[model samples]
Target chain A: MTVGTKHTHLTYPDIDEAVDDDVRQHMEGMMEAEKGVLQAREQEMEECECKEGMFPNPTPGRRAFLLGAAAVAASTLPRGASASSGKAPAGAIEFDVPDDPTKVQGRLTNDDGGYGTRSQFESEARWRFPTKTKETSWTMTPLAESEGIITPSGLHFERHHGGIPTIDPKKHSLIVHGMCDNPKKYSMDDIRKFPSVSRQYFIECSGNGLTEFKAPFLKTVQGTHGLTSTSEWTGVMLSTILNEVGVQDGAAWILAEGADAAVMTRSVPLDKAWDDAMLIYAQNGEAMRPEQGYPLRVFLPGWEGNTHIKWLRRLEISDKPFMTREETSKYTDVVKDGKARQFSFTMEAKSVITFPSGEMKLPKPGFYEITGLAWSGRGKVRQVEVTTDGGKTWLIASLEGPIQSLCHTRFRIPWMWDGNPALIASRCIDETGYVQPTIAEINDVRGLNGHPKFASIYHLNGIMAWTIGADGTVTNAAHKV
Target chain B: MLIHWSKTVILAGSLVAFIAAAPASAQKFNFGTTPSAEEIAKIDIDAMPDGRGLPPGSGTPAMGKNIYANSCAACHGVNLEGVSAAGGAALVGGRGSIGTPKTKKTVESYWPYASTLFDYVRRAMPFDKPGSLSNDEIYAVSAYILNKGKIIGDKDVMNAKTLPKVDMPNKDGFIPDPRPDVFNYR
Candidate 1:
């Protein structure tokens, strides 16, 4: 399979086995050549001495500047694709672009190391959080630059307890035991032999917008609401495998474990397994990214991202939740009454405005399309209402089509800004007949009384408000309760 | 309108018929191989509450002091307060401050089960070098940390029998999730 330079922002993981064998030997020498070629970015962008903010102020020849602002990008530099945050992805080759594309012939076809990378000009990528250890931290998707419902696989948000492990698929097998009559182990090859199903779903970190609960301290939309992403995952139904090994009577819970250095585990309900649980091996039509549990990962639709264990290895069926460190000490909600809430699985409905969001100054907005994403852990988003007057009045925004169940649905509304200080926001109504609540409403019920204040922050689907100033700058209009 | 209703009824009847024809079970996909008892034992390492899966071992807090200092103290402070190097919360103290604004959620304060303390330390402790410690070392460390928080006596032994029976301070602190916590108004 060949991925063309069609979508400039999508990274096509060329995982065809035939191509890997063909390019294995030749690619080794190319990788060695790339080593120790140090003086590149600083060397090429020497003209960018002005150093506006990491990159130079662009005079005119700019497209990367079109997204951010005034970055004098040295396109002359034969540079690798910058994901802006994590390690650079593979298969994208660096070559010189002609000053005028019409005057020169481009690089040879099928020479891009067999896979495709996003364009260098598209600098949108995930950003990491400052946790104690970098390995235990997470990265947020660049929601401000998002275009559609599906987040690019490379740009998908990630959370890891242990560092991402490199596991060979041929050796990895999932062991299923415990409260089951016939305990079984299925290799990756064996699991693939069963019939498979593909579905589009969104995996959201329960702590997605935790920072915004008390106040909007995080400046960017990426910081505020970027921990969720949608992907069309292809996998065999977990129930199909449960059928292979009969679950013993009274087996209600299953402990899913990962093979990472941390050996993470979370107990899942048997009902969820029968409902929509899957052992997904592929994402966005290709093998999963290493950061996303390459060989395999659990896909528990509509559940918190943490429960969907990555680099999955074992399954032990039982009648009780494991109450692991994550569930008890970390993810549990500490409420006002001194009692914590455990096993809070679903992420309620939430939405955020991407364009004209935090840190982006709307350049003299007369007519603009206010676009953003809204999704629910419960089910399909029935409606998304856009508000431009700080929760005064609302209008039903247009929902982008073929809205699937438990997935991110893009919403858009046309607005004519009159250059006044106005608050832009969106609220969602899921199919369950529940409307997204404000921060004040959430505080009233969940009680924003944690040690850190508003520490009962998980499953906070409060409406996000971004204020657009007369000077055309947009900032988070969080009502600090 | 009457014809449309009749058509819907017919469709519903066919759907019920289809449901009845196909059993509500998947035809057994026996592609999986029955794993050997030894293979299952090798990977089944998670320990649940009530002493469910604790390995056979014994240790006292006295034997755990050196292990804690050498292996865990770099991140978790010598005094049981976490260091910046580890970026983890304190292992002790914060016994009652969890739900308050001055909350400090340590193993002593927030954790609901003593089994969880042993389980977490064994599965992922020392941050960098995880699953490296022996079963006895895990038991010893668990006992030492518990004693530091005044949860157990200094001479209390931590074995499969004792660890599960040790009730944590916040043993009954947690409740099940009651969500859609707040509703939207028209």
Candidate 2:
């Protein structure tokens, strides 16, 4: 009762020592008076004085129940007021379990006071790509944690010609000039007013698989093949814009330009522009993320990603492409005999096993689900074959649904491990019935110019193999059988 | 809570006031200003293979020797041969290695256009410093290299007019792509 004093009847010692002698005596006296009153009430019940709905039989075990109830009540009394008063010792505090367990112990406040931070343990992947200049280099996405076909907008990979421009969409306009019957400029709003459509597709860099040409160059699948990504883009088709502008006859090519510091530009053929090209303004169901060209960009399905210009500003119709520096000096592939191959656009069929890939180690040999992504710019992936025994035998993998053309098709195969070392690889076959070739076969056809040039080795859609060692270390086994 | 409502209203009002007070011109975004022809003419020294963009300038090979000594000799050696100076790429010789494995194609050997030499140098050159040379200096250097390679005479004096007319050895070397045929895959 006094919070700290031990009574002769009570067995447990009270932890608090702040209560004085007077408070202890007062609590003990109150307990004694309550006991006396209870005894008198029992005597009266024995004399046949009963209340309504009370048997008043004066059972012998009833006193024990009353004593237990009184002990519980005594412990429930508030003695930790001093704790809230800030007078308790540094380490003597104890938390009480509330009568209602659903109640939260504390309130959280944020800058808006309505939002709260996620649990401290939760984390998301951060981008880590080197930069030579803001415009030229690229940053990779963490593909391992990506779910479904949509890459989370924040983690989308980036490749810019000039630095990212902070363009205010209100003032931005795209001019369709040159070989058009009536050259017209459309503001961002005007362009969006046209009939809009959405489709899921994958944009692959022409140099996506270049590093894997000679050998397994990068450790992670993201590093080796992250240049390819799938997104649901919403936009008005370039055909619709060209229809409004009324393209003139004999216009072979159109030059597209961006509003960045570099004023990046590229030449695209008119046929492709009128066919499947999209002047995209939205990605993954939202306004385009800044890294994916915030306001608007060109989305050419099944074409090289660079040709899908970002921060789009101008489109000039012409009979011949204005061969900008990007086309002539950079993207053009110098072949084996000093002849450079230009306009090599399509990214060929390729696939790589993402799970159990390089840098991953198996904890113990058991049943493992071998999963990966396969895609073809030519058409939909018809079939994916997994070679568990290094191409000696191949089995068709189960292709997941939503296999649209020019999109990444997910493939999975259940593989068993007997704890022995083995080589694993995947090969994709396109709808065109063209099988993805091996490194040797590709090089034999495209003649490796001893000097590495972008043109000679632009498309390296070769089979990627991963070797699991006896110790369970996985490595990019390019040549090791 | 009542005070908090008043504060929120005041903040929203200020934001609306600020946006309303902003100028209409400030709201419109312009990619870039259209530079005047005079201003652009100062920097548009791009020389096409036919010398389309070359400015009015002329230089003899004798004067080029001195200019080349001061400007081009550092990266390209004094004899017009390339230097192996760590970062500098080779600039001369290696002409007929186009189809061979030991090809070392350079300006003297591989370049198909004399005007390209003038164009490239005027736009981006002098490894450490780009766009620093005058049009006359670029023309003089172009003449010196062409005379050394025996493609042009010392008195040809390359300007906008003469630079385009200079005949290059491999001018007809390149052919348009005729592919997607049965032979392309084979």
Candidate 3:
């Protein structure tokens, strides 16, 4: 049952036989060897950090007058007798450096007894949208960097009012009161008693790309349009719950509220609730993660994300709407003509190119895969057109999946960058024949009054453009005339 | 031409019947499915843009100042200035900035209607404790904020009748949407 002596070849049985003298010695020796390797790696990393300025300029033709350049070169050189060995070039050294700082000590043994940490090399964090109130704000998913449709629960973006609260599910209960024959209270377990269903859908913030209305406001796709994400949600139909509670005559609206510090509330029309709304308890086939509302959240398909109240605690049915603060002071569209348009609930169709986008460089720029995401609240994206030289001409990009209605669809195009300056952008057309409008078109419809609050400019779904320079630098370009 | 003639004959016949029955239908003012006064009273808690939904309760500016200080001062600020340093929205004194570069819309200067303040607060306010304030408290706070902003006199009592009558400084600031025009598409 003795384990292997080598670090890479270490097996599990060694721990059980650790009492044996031979096995104990082998385990001790392996630990010492791993520690030595880790220490040496740390020293090498410190040296690299000290001489980071000494590295050869990756950006060709830049002035290389940095004082640490020599140190950077020396530290990067190969280590040990391998440098003198005939196998490699003279002065060449091979350093076994780990890809991430967390992995420097190597993989943990099975009995490590702790949660795993993400690699230090991963620089992703929750993308936040600047807001008027810190307690009530939103964060977005890193959709462009993600490989699949299922947003990782930890990486699931959040929109909260009054901040996130820690709720004990045992003590929490959802009360279906007002305008019902049988006002009922259901615990988390009571909700699970109904017939369960699972479906994948995308929830998009109405203000997903609000910042980019004027221009490209963020450098990364996560910052620009990360407010939308898709997840396989498991739950019972709200209609089924309503049926059990027995809706009374003349019921029109239901006031849904969260138990967060803000007690966020919204008035949802009953017709939509009976159609496709779900009281979700699980996300991505697992128990709901804390950020995705741990215990439960309401899911209203094809509607704005705010109405899908997370950490749901109550539902009060009434003949009229509550006109909550979120729905009034916020969310309502203020037009240019001194009029505020209320009840604007749907998020329009939109698309954006993620790869070769801002803050990226085209490495030699030949044939590259131009990839991005397209989605529509009205229905499936009928087509996505890419314009290589801005809006003058466009070609239809290939859609990659069985286009689902009201879902995020990945689109790709085989683009050849000819080492010349070019402007790239994508436009989406939904099943409803509603073309994604330009910034001017949206402004014309919404109108701008110059006042930041009443500017009617929050939900901007215009086409986004990125410019690639001849020198391989990519920048967010303004919409060309 | 034959089909057109036939359709006209049928329309004429129907119009004659409708004219004949119009008087009978108009004899009674049918407010369709008029709920009992008691039933209506139970659910008519909405605050309208015209102050149509204000409840029977009333609040004065003096009482409202104390209530706001206790419940809302933490986030909204004492002068209703909003916590600008902490990034909270300014709730008062941004009156003439609309259509200008430095517009700071607040209750005193920017809101188009006073009814909105009552509606928004009755349903959601105090940030931490929504739907917890009484109708009188909501009315008083609305009066205090409006009076402080100089929109109304200190003695003014905000009730269903007075709220809609109070004129907002930026009442005419909003403009209609002009889209799908040559300016938008091109």
Give the per-residue lDDT of model 2 (tens digit) for B1-186. 999999999999997897689763243222223334454344333344545556888886877888888877886778777554322345566566553444444566556667667766664565446567787888898898888878889787878888878786645444333222112110
As for TM-score, the candidate ahead, 1 or 3, is: 1
Per-residue CA lDDT of candidate 1, range B25-90, in tens?
Answer: 745657778999999988778788978989999889998999999999988888988775456567
The DockQ leader among the candidates is 1
- CAPRI classification of candidate 2: incorrect
Q: Please give the lDDT score at residue B54 for candidate 2.
A: 69
**lDDT comparison, 1 vs 2, better candidate:** 1
Winner on TM-score (1 vs 2): 1
Among all windows of 10 consecutive residues in model 1 chain A, the one with the lowest summed lDDT is: A1-10
Off by over 4 Å in 1: A1-94, B1-26
- Candidates' TM-scores? 0.85, 0.65, 0.71
True contacts kept of each: 0.84, 0.05, 0.14
Q: Write the per-residue lDDT of candidate 2 for residues A1-481, one digit (tens) a residue.
A: 0001001121212323333333334334323432343344345334332222111123322332344334434565343111122121122232222233244333223332453333211222323333323345565555544455666666577787555779899988777776765566777888888769999898877766555555554555666677778888999888877776667888999878776655566779999998899999998887997778768899889887889888888777777755454554445554545665567677778787876676455655788888888898878999999987878899999999878899988899999977788899998988877677777676655565523321244666778888877655566776442
Per DockQ, what order, best first? 1, 3, 2
